[model samples]
Each structure stands twice: as structure tokens, then as C-alpha cells.
Target: MPLIRYRTGDLGRLLTEPCGCGSQFCRLDRVKGRIAFRSALPSVYDLEELLYGMDTVLDFSARKEENKLCIQVLLAEGGTIGPVREAIEARFPDALVSVSSTLCLVSTGKQLIN
Candidate 1:
């Protein structure tokens, strides 16, 4: 049997060297953001699924900050910021959701920027 390689169009660094942890398989590092900027936003119909896909996202408070729809996502993990940002845009194409460097009043975790 042979394995099929799927082109995910993901922007990342593929490590060819063996891992220090003793794993011989290749590792993909810094798997950040959407594969393509154009595909960052998902379809409107799948908005709900996108929104809930993030593990760190907790709650959100939206407001107009300098004419932009600023959103603060209360997250469980700070690393999920990117996914949250993409999901919000996909969910609300008409509205823009930008994140602030400062964490939500609740805690210091993930935040998304439009």
C-alpha cells in the first residue's frame, strides 16, 4: 500500500532531520495561519462550525473601535488567536473583527485581529 500526499497549501517549514525526542518522522513547524490569504475566510454557511473549531476561544465582546468592529476573544489558550481571527471573518463577512494586544479583562489568553 502507498500513502497519498495531499497538498494543503500550508505555509510552514518541513523538518527533514530526526527529532531530539527520538521520532524519525518529518515534522512540520510553525503551522501558522491559513494556507492562502484568499482562503482565510470560510463560507457563511460553515461559519458556526468555524467559530467553534477553535479550542482556546471562550467568549467574545464586540464593539466599534475606531470605526472597526473590534472583538476580544476570551481564550483558554493564547495560541489559538489565528484560527479565531479567521473564523470570525468567515462568520461575519460584513463585519470586521480586530483584536487588541491587551488580553480581555477576564484573563490573558488568545486574541484575534482582522
Candidate 2:
């Protein structure tokens, strides 16, 4: 047997604080969302799975603005935006996430004046 180097792409939080149960080992928080890899964001299908899978995500459209990645989404009723932002930011730190009712599309579909 060997130590597998496979990445599960499962997103979770590392808990450093001591627990009340007196467990010595650090705990891994429940899975929040998933990404493609540790160094890069997920693929289109993976992004779809990650976004649409969330209860907060109702509709979405992605576009690349130079080095910036943007995802505009519509949320379900009473769904807070924090979790949606976190789910995206946690996986793709480079993304400039903006969740709003407005879905804007560039006419040229290209970065102008860049």
C-alpha cells in the first residue's frame, strides 16, 4: 500500500480551537462545497455542480474580465448571500464574486479599454 496523493476536491474548514469533548486532534468541519483542485478552480460542469447545488443559488452566469472571474447569480427566496459568496470565494479566491438580482452582460463580451 502507498499514501494516495489524490485530491477529493471536497471543501471543509480546519478547526484549530479545542473542542468541549476534550478531543486532542484537530477537527475537520463539515463539507461546505467542492472545487476542482487545490491550485485552480473547478471546470464548467464542476462549477455548475458547485453553484446550482446550493440552495441559495437559483441562476448564474460566469464571465472572465481580464484576470478577474465573475459570477452573477440569482438566489432563492430568503437565501442569504454570505454562504453563496463563501462557497465561491473559498474555492476560487481569484474570483471577484458578485451575487445580485441584476444579470449584466457585456455587449462586446470583451474587456473594453484594456
Error of 2 at 82 (Å): 0.5
Per-residue C-alpha lDDT of model 1 across residues 15-112, encoded as one tens digit per residue = 88899999999876643332122334332113324544667655454444453445566567555577777767665554555454444442233322
Model 2: residue 7 alpha-carbon error in angstroms: 28
How does candidate 2 score on lDDT?
0.63
Q: Estimate each model's TM-score.
A: 0.35, 0.53
Model 1 regions more than 4 Å off: 1-53, 94-114
Cα lDDT, all candidates: 0.49, 0.63
Cα error, candidate 2, residue 107 (Å): 11
- Kindly give the number of clashing pairs for every candidate: 0, 0
* Model 1 pairs whose backbones collide: none
Clashes in model 2: which pairs?
A: none
